[model samples]
Target: MKDEKLLAILRLQKSKAIGDILAKKLIVNVGDVEQIFKEKSAILQNINGIGNHGLKHLFDEKNLKAAEQELNYIKNNNIKYSYFLEDDYPINLQNCIDSPILMFKDGNINFKNDKIISIVGTRNMSSYGRDFCTKIIEDLVQYNPIIVSGFAYGVDICAHKVAIKNNLQTIAVLAHGFEQIYPKVHKKYINQVNENGGFLTEFWSEEQPLRENFLKRNRIVAGISKATIIIESAEKGGSLVTADIANSYNRDVFAVPGRTTDIYSKGCNNLIKNNRATLLTSSEDIVKMLNWDIKESPKKAIQKQLFVDLNENEQKIYDLLSEKGQQLLDVISLECNIPIYQLSSILLQMEMKGITKPLPGKLFELM
Candidate 1:
């Protein structure tokens, strides 16, 4: 974290045309972040993905001035940050190809042995989603997992609050800089969040929370956790984008299944229906799926019934799964001769009955 190297990183981050992917390429090709700025434009362009459009802004005098100002703010305010190459960078985010090269963090954030899970969903929270958030955090208290979220309204703030209530570390990944809080209303929770965990962002202090900034921040939220859970969402929302990003990173995704007619639940139901996420009924689904068996003495006891009654369609699906071990939704539909439209409803009911559970990649099996 030499002053000179930090400035170069800030300058590279200011480039509009050079994204995280291209920036990392330049860093790797040049062998150092500082070397990218010192190397001639012609030599830098020789690297793959470096082009005239990008190089134009790369060395722009305006960008240099902006970086200088940002650097001054970091130094004067004693702001904390993590470089992607450094050991302190989030371990989960390091594996992602498009993770930010640098991120500013605040609060008593600790990365010691802890399970991190991001719980995100719509800003318009319903009673069901709210209750689930509270219940899940309460259930997960035994694991001492760090709850990660957007720190926005609804499910985001709900997750953070429950984490704080349960005495668990919670990280709020902001879309804007640490200089300001978005939605303005959530400012009340800032101090509490810092006390429990902290705030994280890749944006510079002067940057505003724009539409695209949120989309970009979604990756960090998705990447910086062992799993991403969607409590509820509309047919479309930022949480779904986070789920997609987590899937791309080969991370586990869990979505709370809601009734088919619930408007806000459509996105989560679709995610589970399509097999992009597992059907999350309760904390046991997470414990079982993630194999969170650390510290044997402290493990939560999950009692599952030995068997549950299954009706005709449920029995058919159950019989097929019991026979085939685990089967894709499409394969089960085809093999069991159950039409997908009807089968979807049947499977959902079966899930509620604790007869079967959905898995990532559309697979289903007896629970």
Candidate 2:
């Protein structure tokens, strides 16, 4: 992106009152991010949700100075970033409604592989949690998933280390800016994480790791992946928050159930009991639930028996499955343009006809 355009985005991001959703609205309505600045107040005020209070911050002189300083730091450091609307932005996160408009990147992070999962848990991880975290990542090495974590103590660091040990890409989502590392002790693993995967954050260079920032950071951890795995969590902790955020995003969340008496297990058990997350026992659950075990083969023409009757929607679904191989329920619904409520019944009907079979994780495939 051009300096001017990036600067405009930074300025918008720095605006105190205008958040990502409203910023997006302003961008879409104005037709250009930079033009939002050049447009007259009267014209911008005409846009819905753009009131006087928002306008005051949108053009705040202090924001421009801050944005410029940040921009210069970005240029000087040769920092990498992804604009929410850009092609480089993570696709999974892009689908999230509250994802950051601009995310900074470090190290050699790669999003080419869509097989990404975030693993998080209590910082006071127990032996059971540690073993499960290691075993799960090691088992998942075959699929070479990108392991994402907060780069904090306990489960987060363990996930990163295990991913590194398995030669899998592991990304650390930071609560603070690039200038400082939280828990400062984790600095030793920084080089390894960078070489193996990288770090990601939405904060600027000088941002600190505030308490609220950690809460906000959980959303990124949840939003950036296809699924979230909670190896262990206390009855109340950040991992639970991440799981909630993941659930809100309609992403799959898996919690490893443990003995109810165990402090760390309480959160996972509650998540399972409350139906907030799937009960994960082993890596097999993840593989099956994510349909990772299903590999796409060469597509061939549909071969249905002539005697079998099919409706329009069923035919559309059959064709899609035949072309794309196994697909998630949501993807099928989207591609077939069928409502989820209707799609479920249609899929059941197809299943009864021995045309399609359901897989774990709401995936469906032709039998």
Candidate 3:
């Protein structure tokens, strides 16, 4: 919690081309980060790759001032930075060779959970891709797993939003720092996540969202999860990079299969064909792979009995909606063989009791 120690770590991380290697070196040899400044020349020379150019900047007054400014910004904004040695740091990521030495975070972080899963995929997703991601997320939320994603445009955004909608904790590991979200449009949702879950980043506040950072960020996403699920991806996509990293880390990688003709499905199909990833049809696939228990027999039976207690008419409506997902009032009346006027009142009562939810275009679905 020492401000000076935190500031020194931030300055080292901010330096380009000097990453965790130098950070670890400073921690091990210098006794403390402040000592790095005093013995700057000798320390730089001892490191293999670091040259005089890098060493010169380390002692520059301007660089120290910049680090102070960055530290001041974090303190003023109430941002939290967790170093690798900190208790709150994610243990899953601590062992990785290139793991981030520091992480800037905002909101609750639950590293103790065994159910953390990373849902990643292509930015360009089809409607099927959207539905698949949303359904699996909703199902997984029931178990209260921590959802992790990049918070990008297509699949990433869908997974985060659905987790939030279900009141589940969702974390976004950003390519940039917490000073600014990458896609400003997602700023609102990112704030919502901060209020509920949190955002994590390796870069300091002043670091821009560079392309290489994302590739580095992907490893953390993969390494921290029990499994990595790819909803959809092209043959060459960021999700595939994550899947490869997950495999290398000896974690399970699951891919949802898409049609062979689909450009997005090609990646998934290829993964399954080559045995690079297991084919995931539903949340059960992931749960089973992780050896999570399905609800016990007694609890499942109780739920079944509760489900059976619905009145005949309610059961009929539930069955119709469950099969078709959503239907307009007219469609429901026809499908359930009920009079339109009577069905209207019944649907209203069901909606009021949370038996179903209304959607746009005058559609309703079983809850």
Candidate 4:
């Protein structure tokens, strides 16, 4: 990319009022990101969602100076980045409406492997959570997935370490910038992590990890993968926030159930009870839910499963999916005369019965 283009992106990103969604709107409407800086403020304000508050920050001279400084830091440090409009941006993240318009990357990170999943949970993890985290990554090693996490304590670091042990790539998403690593104690693992996969962040070189930054970075952890797994979480934690973001993005979410009385288990159990996440027992659950083995199974397998017992609604959904090949969730609801609220449960039942499976973007078809 041209230096001027990069500078414009940095300037737009520096605008506190204009977030990713509105920034994308301005870029699309104006036909060029760089041109947004050149266009008259009155003309830019004419675009929908471009209010005075945002325009004030967009054209602020202080923001221009900050962008220039950050651009220099990026150049001096040889930092790598991805523009939302660029082809190199992660496809999964690109689909998220609120994903960062600009993101920084480092080390040996590669997007060639499409199998990516984010594992996150509480920092105060129990032995049970640790063992389960290790076992799942070991089992999934054969698939060579790129494990993603926040690189914090407990489940995040556990997932990263296990992935490296299995020789699988691992990505650590940072809430701060590359200039500093949080929890200075974990600094020892920095070299190993970089040699294994690398780091990613949307923050500038000197940004610190503030309380809200962790919440903000959760979306990237959720959006950059096929699914987000909560190994263990308390009643309230950042991992739960990541799970919510993943669900909002229409991606799969899985939670490991623990004993009801266990403090860390409350969140996972609630997610399962509320139907916000799938109850994960082992690696097979992840593989099956994400349809990782779909290619190995024969298409004829669908025909054999036709004899499986299904409820009236499940049968209706099965027949529709069987005939239509693959249909959107809304279309299935209409054709089967099932309300979306009711259809979601019916389809999940079919999935568990091995008669159907979900595809990305809420599409479904027979297994």
Candidate 5:
């Protein structure tokens, strides 16, 4: 089918409530989306919440044309759309009551992966919040899970960066469209994600990042994952929205507790206190909650022999890298006070021994 025609239909379908109603309507109608375009005003008026006023908004020629422009833009930019009927569409999202009608996808995704976790939190995060996020994400990578999050600032970005650094697939669910990225500072990072992973959204490329869209987006983030983790949030932040939605969907919700007096942590603590979320002190808690089997430790003799073979500098680096999965070369050098040239050779030697691997930006991690 011509891409424009397909998108036009999707753009029209976007106006409908995105659940069984729309799914049934599309199934019963079973034709080009443009044909139903004419019936939208009358049809929407009959649906609850979409009164004559809202119906009129649907029929606006300017809006329809703008939506067409968006479709064209998406096609131009090489973005692809996946509808609920598509085989590759996310099954978890499809199971939701208010799943998106169409999603704009920009990278590789194995939607069928058994392990998926949504990490969400406030856009404004504390230092402790960042550290907590880093530690948990590093641990989660061991299971090769897909990490989901909104591409917002603070905790969201931290999770994404960590996922990428650890060679995990991360999906950013945007509140806006593929046409533009909100919080443009993330544009560079988003590009990097697209190159390595991807971004997803229900809105068309031209759709604005309206305040209400974010609330709707939160549902997707919550719905698509097996569990949702809130690292930090203000009492009224949007992370709570994702947690509530996760609860409604019967997905596990985890919150990390912090000092009661800390503003950013109040939301997490409250959720835990109310029994709305499980209190997670470490990644081990989440792994256990999910019933994932932890890998057994290597035999003591094997570990001892492996340690004995390492030279003094190599042993020091190995110890540091084992404690944390990844560390920048500069950080390692500074901590060990080793010359860069010597450190490079040691890192290469360790890599040859299958003890570590290089990551983006000169970082290295234990294998």
Candidate 6:
């Protein structure tokens, strides 16, 4: 990014009222981020949610100074960043509705390989959690999947260490800024993590790891991967929050079932029981559930699975699209005798199953 564009984004990010979600909307609404600054308040206020209150914060002079200071720190430290619109941004995280607009990274971080999955659990992991986590990462080494986790203690550090030992890429998504690392003792593992993969954060250079930041940070952990696996979690904990966010994004979620008596196992147990997560036993489960067994071609694999997995209703809908070609959502609903209300959810399910894909203008087609 140019100096002007970077500064504008920093300033917008520092603004109080405008968050990541609204910042994206403003940029899209105004045609560009820099244009947001050049456009008059009258023009900006015309945007759906932009009002006098929002405009005041959008152009706040105090935030400009803060942004400039932060930008200076970034330049002085030779920090690297990826804008949401840029090609270098993490592809999975890009699909999230509320992903950070800008992310700072360090170390030899390569996102070219798409086999990224997050392993997250409670800070107070037990012996069962430790053994399962280690064995699973070792088992998954051959698949060359990138392991993602928070750099906290217990399960987080265990995942990072095992991934490094297995010679696999492991990304640590931090809750605090680059200047600080929580649990201070975990600092020793930082070099190992960078050597294997690296650190990624949405926070600025000097931000603290406040309580609320961890909750906010959970979203990135959940959204940055193809799936999130919970080795162990208490009934109420951060890992559970990550699982919830993953489900909301319609991503795959896996929880290791354990003895119901274990306190740390409560969350994972409930997750499996409530149908919020699939039961996970070994590395094979992950590979099978995620369809990592690559065969001939993606299209051919999906086609072959259709006959084996599609139900009567799904088959009718799939057959119509296969025969008639791409059609509108309403048209498919009418032709297949499925109501519009029911068709929407069916389409979403088909999308998750890799059977059909949705296109612009409410169009649908076989994958």
- lDDT per residue (tens digit) for residues 1-367 in model 2: 9999999999999996998868876776676889999999999998778899999999999999999999999999999999976668887776666678899999998899999999999999999899999999998998999999999999999999999998999999999999999999999999999999999999999999999999989999998999999999889999999999999877899999999789989999999999999999999999999999998796665576642699999998998777556666655654566756788999999999888999765668998
TM-scores, one per candidate = 0.80, 0.82, 0.75, 0.82, 0.71, 0.83
lDDT of 4 by residue, 1-367 (tens): 9999999999999998999878877876676889999999889888788899889999999999999999999999999999975667786786677889999999899988889999999899999999999999999988889999999999999999999899889999999999999978889988888899999999999999998999999999999999999999999999999999999988899999999999999999999999999999999999998888777644553563555677787877777667546666655654565756677888888788777899887778887
Q: lDDT per residue, candidate 3, 1-367, as tens digits?
A: 8898888887776665566756655555455666676674865587566677677666667777888998898889988888875557675565454578788888887777768899999999899999998899887776789999999999899998888889888889999877678888888786788766888988778677899989998998997787899999998988999999998866799999988989999999998989999999998888788877655453221232546557777778887776445555544554455755677788887777678787754567776
Q: What is candidate 2's TM-score against the reference? A: 0.82
Tell me the spans in candidate 5 whose CA falls farther than 4 Å from its real position. 1-5, 14-60, 294-367
Ranking 3 against 4 by TM-score, winner? 4
55-164 per-residue lDDT for model 5 (tens digits): 55556676666777776676678777787545566766655655765778888777767689999998888999999999998987778889999999999999999899
300-348 in candidate 6: lDDT tens per residue? 4235454687777788888877755565665565456675677899889
The candidate, 3 or 5, that scores higher on lDDT is 3
Listing every candidate in turn, what is its Cα RMSD in Å to the true structure after a full C-alpha superposition? 14.8, 7.1, 20.8, 9.9, 18.9, 8.6
lDDT of 4 at 45: 82
Clash pairs for candidate 6: none
Better of 4 and 5 by lDDT: 4
Q: Which parts of model 2 have CA positions greater than 4 angstroms off?
A: 298-367
Q: What is the C-alpha local distance difference test score of each model?
A: 0.86, 0.90, 0.79, 0.88, 0.77, 0.86
| Number of residue pairs clashing in candidate 1, backbone atoms closer than 3 angstroms, sequence gap of 3 or more or interchain | 0
Could you give candidate 1's per-residue lDDT for residues 249-282 as a string of tens digits?
7789999999999999999999999999999999
* Candidate 3 stretches greater than 4 Å from native: 47-54, 294-367
